[model samples]
Target: MTVDDSLSRGIGPVAMTVLPQAAADDDERAAAHWSGQLATFGLLEAAERHFRPAAEEGDLTAVKCLVWLARQDGREREAHSWLERAAGAGDAWAMYELGVSLPRPEGLEEAQRWFRRAAEAGHALAMNDLAALLARAGRREEAKDWYLRAAEAGVTTAMNNLAIQHVLGGDRAEAGRWFERAARAGHVDAMANLGRLRLEAGEEREAASWLGAAARAGHQGAAGLLAELPGAAEAAGEAGLP
Candidate 1:
């Protein structure tokens, strides 16, 4: 990946400059709530002034917010500490986000701990990410179990990944079933991949539809294959099929 993309992935999206919608509709408290954010955004002095009080008062939301800021500011140590505190306090989302943020080896172990905690608490993405990590570490059976957990929790990425695993394991039928689930959930890569696999199995009509769906979703390879279908070859000036 490009440096900019890599950095963007590591840091997450830009910080929101406003309060959440729930906090906004409270007419009386909205002003006070936003005043703190205004301070944070440089409209007032003491940027963290609003966040500090909430954090000190042990507000989980405030702790999460502070951790987000630390992540944005590249303060890994502070973020790590805050995440540990929140995760220990039974914040599944915090545990999952921390799992996603830490480094490998040490980070991976830490990530697994938080992910396992969050997964047990019913965090879908944590289960999915943890399954991916387990698969990468060559624990395929355990990974499949985690993938099933994430799939049960409605994680489409886990569905797609599990389909690939099935395909690699020579269980094409099962793989197709998972691909169908992922495609129905609008996973573009899964649609494209399933389209190709279907075509290889001589299910051209279904493959074309899937390829068309994937192409419409901006998968360039799918678009290319869709362009090569039947009459499309003639449109591209190729000779008739043998």
Candidate 2:
């Protein structure tokens, strides 16, 4: 559909800055952009109207968005079909999504296969997930390797997970460094974790700072821990903590 057709259908005018003029003129890119915005606003019918045509034309991003829309509409089978079509075309994101969507235990092997493929294609999140699967299967060394790869690729969760691996390996120094890195990147769990580590090392002020940061980020556990620190509640209230 044309841009005017999209606007006429009550999708409203999208900000030009959000979508470049060149992309607006490209049918596939326009469809993907409009479908994503529609999907975000729960306009599933309108999103599908834009997405299906692009997906049929082999736009991997559109196929991925269609999969999400299908799942949101409780059409699991349709989502899987779209995922498979995109994954078959070697789309890294589609492979990762397909891996995560598969039923656990029964589909574990298939999920790992797809995760591995996606990871090999340089999908950072896939590397993190593959590490988790390997860790579950008692492959600690391989899991650590994958986690390191993902962490280096700037996945904050991978950095957190890798820190946990270091802790398990009794390398507290390395673990603390990783936790600090992830926390600086705004990973709430890592903030809580680093706070706990600091508390254990008798660095109460540092611990409270990290814990307060995590608490303000809506981490219930961090909030609870922060409440246990002396004078923390008053400090939090003074800082307008919500």
Candidate 3:
């Protein structure tokens, strides 16, 4: 399969080659690979062997991998230890992941702190997530700021969510603008929502374009909505997309 196809959907067998199964007397490298495999395959106990040694040895990458797997297994305390090591090693992604896995109190203060650190280190998704936390806590102005930053950083999901926030806040104009921005960036939900909005406003031609965009981008709900439109099937066939 092409690179785009591999990334466009769920993980496949070959793409999950980060981990391998361990033998009775696996070497360190084999053990590490096996551990990765165990995590990938959801064999939590079997994966521990791959992570434990390198984590104990202060290997940042291993600590990150183990921490992520531990979080998936709900072993938060162990994940915390590994995350601390990786965070201390200056891994910004580790800080972001650690923030997400930790428990929250009083509106994600701890998570915000770490997300801020990661954002400063140029982690776009962390910036978006941080914006969401801020928005949930009623820090709309600050949230908007972070959303703008993340959107500029090419995070299309952030752009779409930010547009939703604008819409929720009764700024349909701003929402439409941002929705268009995200749609151009290939955000499927943005395309669908924007299309729906236009349709509601009787902008049939524009709605058809956006709905087609959404369907081509694999938004199933948008595809269904498109099917409900007059002559939509013909439009979809003529588009020659998806």
Q: Is candidate 1 or candidate 3 better by TM-score?
A: 1
* Model 1 quality (TM-score): 0.73
What is the total number of backbone clashes in candidate 3? 1
Model 1, 118: alpha-carbon shift in Å?
1.8
lDDT comparing candidate 2 with the true structure? 0.80
Q: Highest TM-score: which candidate?
A: 2
Off by over 4 Å in 2: 1-33, 36-62, 65-69, 232-242
Clashing pairs in 1: 103-107
Model 3 CA lDDT for position 48:
56
Clashing pairs in 3: 19-37
Pairing residues by index, what is the TM-score of model 2? 0.75
- How far is 78's C-alpha from truth in model 2 (Å)? 1.8
What TM-score does model 3 achieve against the real structure? 0.65
lDDT of 1: 0.71
Rank all candidate structures by their TM-score, best first, as comma-separated numbers: 2, 1, 3
CA error at residue 118 for candidate 2, angstroms: 0.7
C-alpha lDDT of residue 186 in model 2: 88
Model 2, position 88, has a per-residue lDDT of 97
Q: Ten residues in a row with the worst lDDT in model 3? A: 19-28
